[model samples]
Every structure is written in C-alpha cells, then in structure tokens.
Target: MKKILLPTDFSENSWNAITYALQLFKNEECTFFLLNTFAPAVYQVEYLLVMPQPDETLNVYKESSLRNLEMLKERMQTEFSNPKHSIETISIFNTLVHQINEEIQDKSIDYIIMGTKGATGAREILFGSNTVFVLKKVKCPIIAVPETFTYESPHEILFPTDYGINYQDEHIQPLLNLTGNNVARINILHVDKGRGLTEYQERNKQQLESYFKHSAYLFHSVQNESVQEAIANFQLKVRVNLLVMLNNKHSFFENLFFKSTINQIGFHLNIPFFVIPTKLGKK
Candidate 1:
C-alpha cells in the first residue's frame, strides 16, 4: 500500500492539496496520513524546564488540533469515498518539518503532498514559508499543490533540469513510479545559456537518457530567453499537466523562480509541482 503524508493547517489550501492527492492516486491503493502540528502561542522557560506540556495553552492547542484532524478525516471520507484509499489522522504538538520527518519513518511514507500556502496567497511567492522550510529540511519527495489548482490527470509532465547533480536511483524512483503508473510522457526541457553542457553535466544527461530509454519522452533545448520565460512558453505551447524539479542547491532549481519577465507567478507553476529534495541522494 502507498503511504502518503498530508500535513494540513485545516485551511482550504491544505484541503485543496489533500483532494488533489486523493484523485491523483484514485486507482492505486493508498493509506493517507492527515497530520496537523501545533505549538503553544507562547512558551515560558520555567514551563519548558519543568513540565513539558503546560495545562492551559498547550491543552487548548492540542484539543483544537485534534478536532481539526478528525474533521479533515471525516471530510475526506465523505467527499472521496474510495475502497482503495484509507486515511489516518494525527495531531501532534511539534514543528511541521520535524513532524513530517518523524512520520516518514513511523509510517514509511512515500510522498508528502501539501499546498503552497494558506488561502489565495500572493502568487509571487513560489512557496509558503512552511513549505520552503520543509523543502530544505525534508528529504522525502513532495508535491506542492497550488492554492487554486484544480485536480487534473498528470498525463504530460514538464521536467526542467540543468543536470548539475549526479543522478541517483533513489532520486529517480518517485518519477519512475509516477510515470509508470500513469503511463505518462515526459517532456525534458534544457534551457540553453549560450553554453554547452559540462563534461559532468553531459554524463548526468547520458544517465538520464538511459533512465528514460524505455519511456516516452522528448528533450528540447531552447535559448534567447530567461529560464523562467522558457518554462512559461513551453508550458503554454504544450499544455503540460505537471512540472517537476529537484531542490538541488547551486542548480537551476535554486534560482528558477527568482527572476521572471512577468514578475508574477504563472499557472505554469500552478500545475502540481513535483519537488525531489537534493540531499536525498545516497548518504
């Protein structure tokens, strides 16, 4: 069974992401973990040194968190009743990233699906504060669902890579599982900056080519525009259903969204983004 970890703040945005994940893996048997983390509004040093959890504020937060998790589970059961999907709820007084990492081990989670932000937040921000922190701290594969994105079959996937990091089997496993399950075609786009691939990059490219040998994919190289512009134009031209990238430091993924000619987030990023954490490579 597939174990999918869903961290929710009980907001519509988080609910949006949960709904998308359910529909995305509707056919496959999955156990979804609905988790909500809470911390006291204020922590007193005396309380921390003495009692781990206080009586008043901590109790209030715990009750609220538990209530919200139960409600979310009920909502999921009522709205999306699928024999293949079973959901479990968790309410913990911990930080988001720490809770997620713990659950990844406790439940053997496969994917962490979450919204980019709460409510209709500014699209200028690529990810919410929690999400960006989680991306940096968590090594598990995660899917960031935009606030207003409607669920769609990920038939066409757009993968933007600079081929900077060495390829690893663990890094590619999630992509392989997803594409293999959906029988989707991958469109690999390489943004040309008037320079050729370095020897290391070429090696990584060859490895990627080998990995996709039995799959249907097209490699496109485009130039004369910024990487962000290139991505938006490609999405416009192809109507891609998903956009994927690795959070590899010092790579294109690190700076992909910083500068754009439009100066705003596009539906290009609105498409469900599959982010593979870079540090997930072999220990």
Candidate 2:
C-alpha cells in the first residue's frame, strides 16, 4: 500500500492539500497519515527547556492538538468517504521539520504532500520557511501545493531537468505512476546552454523517453536561458497543471530554492511542485 504523509496546522490551505491528495489517489489503495506538529510558544518552550515536566499550559496545548486532529480525521471521512484510503492522525509535541523527519522513517512514508505555506506563514516569502526547510532536509519525494492552487485534474505535467543525472525508472516512479495510470501527458523540458547535449546526456534522454514510450509525452528544448526563466515561459505557454523536478545536488533545483528569497530571482511557483529527492538518506 502507498503511504502518504499529510502535515497540517488545521488551516484551510492544508485541508485543501489533503483534499487534493485524496482525490489524486482515490482509486489506488493508500494509507494517509495526518500529522500535526505542535510546538509550545516561544516563552513556553524556554520554560520547558528549564523544566523537566511540562506545565498545565503545555498539557492544554497537547489536548487541543489531539482534539483538532481527531476532528480533522472525521471531516476527511465525512467528506471524501473513500474506502481505498485510510486516515491515521498523529499529534506530536515537537517542531514541524523535526517531527516530520521522525515520522518519515516511523511510518515508512512514500510521499509528503502539503501546502507551500500555511495560514500563519507570511505571504511575502515565496516559499514558506517550513517548506524550504523540509525541501532541503527531508529525503522523501514531496508534493507542495501552492496556497492559491485548487484541485484540478493534471492533464499536463512539466518535468524540468538538466539531464545531468543518469535516468532511472525508480527515480521517477512517482511521476510515471501518475501519468501512466491516468490520462496525463508528461512534458520534459531541458534548458540548454547553446551547447548541445553531451554523449552521456543524449543516452540519458533516450532512456527517459523510453520510460514513457507508451504514455503521451513531449520533449522540449529551449536554448540560451536560465532554467527558472525557461520554466516560467514554458509554464505560461503550456498552462501546465503540475510541475515536477528532481532535486539533485549542485543543480538548478538547489540553486532555485536554496536561497534567502525566491521572489528576488523573478519567479514564483504558482502550481503544485512535485520534488523527488535524487538521494534519500538510508533508514
């Protein structure tokens, strides 16, 4: 069974992401883990650092978290009512990223689906602080749903790559599963530096094409432009529904996100971004 993690803060944005995930995998038998990471307020955390036992106020926070999670689960069951999916709610008294890391191994999570930024997060930051943290540290494939994005059947998926890493079926299994299982088209975008593909890159490209040979696919090559610009223009041109990218180190994915600000670079991801980690830390 596929195991998917849904981290929520009981916000409408997070609930929307959960709704999207459930609908996306409604036909496939899957287990959904609804996780809520509750951290004490600033002053309370400082106090807890000094005190061995959490005070009554801390217990109140824990109680509220558990209650909200249970309510959320009930809401999911009432609204979606999909027998193929199982909802498991977990409420932890820990930080967001830290708790997410712990659950990744404990639950053997397949995919992490969440909103880019939640209600409490500032809208000014392109990618929320929590999302950037998870994208950098977590090793699992993550699907970040933009706050403004609504549930739409993804007919066109844009997978931008440099063809630097050798293509592997296992690497893109998540993506291929969606496109092949459903009536979706995979659009592969490669930004070239005026120089054509190298011998190895050409082989990798062929291998990738071979993987989706039976499915509807299109490969596009744009010359002499930054990867971000190419993605922006192509997304606008095609009106892509989903954006997929492999987060390989020292690549465009890292350069685009591993920064203080994303808006400073003149591009903001408006669609759901499916990021697959090139390398995952061993459990």
Candidate 3:
C-alpha cells in the first residue's frame, strides 16, 4: 500500500491539498498520514527541562494540535470516504520540517502533498517559507497544490529541465508512478539560452528519453527567452494540469526558485507542482 504523508495546519489551504491528494490516488490502496506540529510561541528553557504539567502551555498546545487533527480526520472521512484510502492522524510538539522528516522515515512515506502557501502565506509569494524549506531540505518527492487551484485530472504535465544533473531511476520514479497511473502526456521543455546542449547534457537528455520511452511525451525547445518566460508561454499554449521539475542544485531549479525576494518571480504558478529531489552530480 502507498504511504503518503500530509502536513496540515488546519487551514483551508491545507484542506484543499488533502482533497487533491485523495482524488489524485483515489483508485489506489493508500494510507494517508495527517500530521500537525506545534511549538510554543515563546521559547522557554524551563519548558523543555521540566515535565509538562496539566496547566502548562506545552500541554495546551499539544491538546489543541491533537484536537484539530482529529477534527480534520473526521471531516476527511465524511467528505472523501474512500475505502481504498486509510487515514491516520499525528500530532507532535516539534518543528514542521523535523517532524515531517521523522514521519517520512517512520511511516515509509511515498509522497508529500502540501499547499504551496501556508495559512499566513502572502498572495504575491509563489511559495510559503515552510514549503520552500521542505522543497530544498527534504529529499522526498512533493506535490505542492496552489491554494486556489481546484482538483483536475492531471492529463497534461509540463517538465522543464536543464539536464545539469545525472538522471537516476529512483529520482524519476515519482513521475513514472504518476504517468503509470494516469494517461498523462508529458511535455519536456528545454529553454535555450543561445548555448546549445553540451556533450554531458546531451547524454542526460538521452537518459531522460529512455526513462519515459513507454510514456507519451514530446520534446519542446524555446530560444531567446528566459526559463520563466518559456514556462509561462508553454502553459498558455497547453492546458497543463501539473508542472514537474528535478530539484538539483546545479539545475535551474535553484536560480528560478531560490531568489531572495519571493515576489520577484515572473510567473504565477496555478497548477500542482511535482518536485523530485536529486543530489548534485548523482550518477
């Protein structure tokens, strides 16, 4: 059975993401872990050193987190009552990324479905701080749903790559799994910056082709435009439901996403984004 980890803050944005995940894998047998992490607003050294009393703020935060998770689970059961999906709730008094890593390891999570923005996310920002941190720090595959995006069949996928890192089977397995489950057409986009593909890039590109040989895909090239522009124009031309990328440090993923000013991004992402992590120069 597929084990999927979902971290929620009990916000509508998180709920929308959860619903999207359920519909995305409705036909498959899966276990969904709903996780909520809480920390005290004020850091007190004594809070950690001493045992928690009933009236302590730590207990209060823990109770609220557990209560909210249970409520969310009940709502999921009522709204998306799928027999193929089993729901589990987790409430921890830990940091978001830390607990997420723990759950991923303990539960053997396959994928993480989360909102691009959090409860306090700004509208102009493409991704919230938590989402960005996970995308960079966590190695597991993630599917980030836009807060306002409604669920749709991912029939068309847009994958933009610079072919900087070597391709691995496990690195591309998430994309493979999605394509295997859905009749999706992948549009492999390569943005040309006047410099043609190098010998190494050519070999990596060929490896990608071999990986997706069984899936329906087409190679697309755009010249004299930024990667952001190419992606925006491509989405305009084709009604893409999902956007995918391999988050390699050497790739364009960092330059396009890891800007100091989040709002400076040129394109507005409206579809679900699938991020597959790969180490730098991983063979």
| Candidate achieving the largest lDDT | 3
lDDT of 2 by residue, 151-240 (tens): 887899999988888877658887877775568999999998988999999998988988888888999999977888888889778979
What is the lDDT for 182 in model 2? Answer: 69
* Candidate 1: residue 43 lDDT (0-100): 55
Candidate 1: tens digits of C-alpha lDDT, residues 1-283: 8899999998899999999999989889999999998765475444444655546647878888888888889989999999999999898766678779889878778899999853344444566778877877888899989887998888899998888879887777788888877868898888878888999989999999888888899998998877778889998789788888877878877666433532354534678889987766222
Residue pairs clashing in model 3 are none
> Which scores greater on TM-score, model 1 or model 2?
2
Per-residue C-alpha lDDT of model 3 across residues 29-54, encoded as one tens digit per residue: 99999999776656554563363333
Q: Which stretches of candidate 3 lie over 4 Å from their true place?
A: 44-55, 118-123, 280-283
Report the Cα lDDT for residue 202, model 1. 93
Q: How do all models score by TM-score?
A: 0.88, 0.91, 0.91
For model 2 the local lDDT of residue 125 reads 60
Question: For model 2, how big is the CA root-mean-square deviation?
Answer: 2.7
The per-prediction CA RMSD against the true structure, in angstroms, equals 3.4, 2.7, 3.2
